[model samples]
Target: MPPDALALYATVILLLPMACFFLSSPTFLLVGLEIPEVTQLLRGLFNGYFIVMCVAGVASAVAYVISGRPVFAVGALAVAAVAVMARRWFLQHMDVELQARAAGEAAAVPRLRALHLKGMLLNGILLATVIANVPLVV
Candidate 1:
């Protein structure tokens, strides 16, 4: 795929889990795996959330196609939904981590911070790309 399309795919993939991660669980799939157990489990648990994201994307794409213009809004909403949910979840988790830090569990704080940054960066990029594509429209 071209870099643009690849980025779009990445955005879609990120959204679903992000939403679910916030609403329910932190489990997710990494690129590589020993047994793929964690990945499979997370995917299984959040499958409905993923479906909702994809459906939202497709619906937005349909509207864009009908209008004969690119609307990054579709992608943007998807990303935002995910980010909102993920952030909510992250904040909740962060509270726990904060307490742990107070208790001198420094190790978990760094790891959680890393994960938070990673999620924020990824979602931010996805949202930006969606907006950038608006002029090009679909």
Candidate 2:
């Protein structure tokens, strides 16, 4: 692919997840929904978001490789790995903690909150990484 096309792909890969993050975040509370409902909605939204991230990551990696940018390719692959880990481990742990909290295990509440915060931090880092790379990739 041409360099411009590759840059466009990279931009899409980075921006789409950011958009999803904003849409599913605590700001959803402004719509007047209950906390549990927002949590449930975000959980479902993230299921799709993770899949999107995985696809976008792979596509970005391939684009980078085609554009002769091996470092960017590796970074994209790392993003994909993180996406998989977030989906498999972090999300599952959050679900388990949520269930435990529902079962009256008070300790699970803090753990769940921590997991959410970690996820937010991870997203922030990922976004920053993409932003930092955008100029070089373009």
Candidate 3:
């Protein structure tokens, strides 16, 4: 396979989370004044998280099938599971944030930072796993 194909695949997988993140924001989702259910409230959180996971899963599956690397599949599955768990944790923390806000407290920045950090971590893990599976083309 050509190097360009592999690079494009990797780029697609890496950009998926960012796409989801952008969609999750109200400012990013406004086509009109009214916001749809998918981009509103808790549903946005769930949708964004799950869609990102699904994108990553499908992307990694394609890469694994193309590259003939089962390790990529395993890494993708790990990433999906971690994403789900992290989503749950995010909801819990978001609840805390809401409570704090209701009590006249400011929102914490670490929560947002952690979300981006998690995405980076997943990307790093997937990249390393895929690179490790590169076969010699003798």
Q: Top lDDT: which candidate number?
A: 2
Taking the tens digit of each residue's C-alpha lDDT, what string does model 3 give over 30-60?
3321223322354355547555875686676
Model 2 segments more than 4 A misplaced:
28-36
Best first by lDDT, ranked:
2, 3, 1
- Give TM per candidate: 0.41, 0.82, 0.49
The TM-score between candidate 1 and the true structure equals 0.41
- The 10-residue segment of model 3 with minimum total lDDT is 30-39
Residue 13's lDDT within candidate 2 is 74
Which lDDT value does model 1 have at 129?
A: 64
Q: Which 10-residue span in candidate 1 carries the lowest summed lDDT?
A: 26-35
Candidate with the larger TM-score of 1 and 3:
3
- Runs in model 3 lying further than 4 Å from the true structure: 1-11, 18-50, 62-67, 106-138
Give the per-residue lDDT digits (tens) of candidate 1, residues 1-138.
Answer: 354554455445444554454545433323322223543443344344444555556555544444443445455455546645764565556556555655677475465546545654554565566556544542
lDDT scores in order: 0.49, 0.74, 0.52
Candidate 3, clashing residue pairs? none
lDDT of 2 at 26: 50
Model 2 / residue 35 / CA error / Å:
5.0
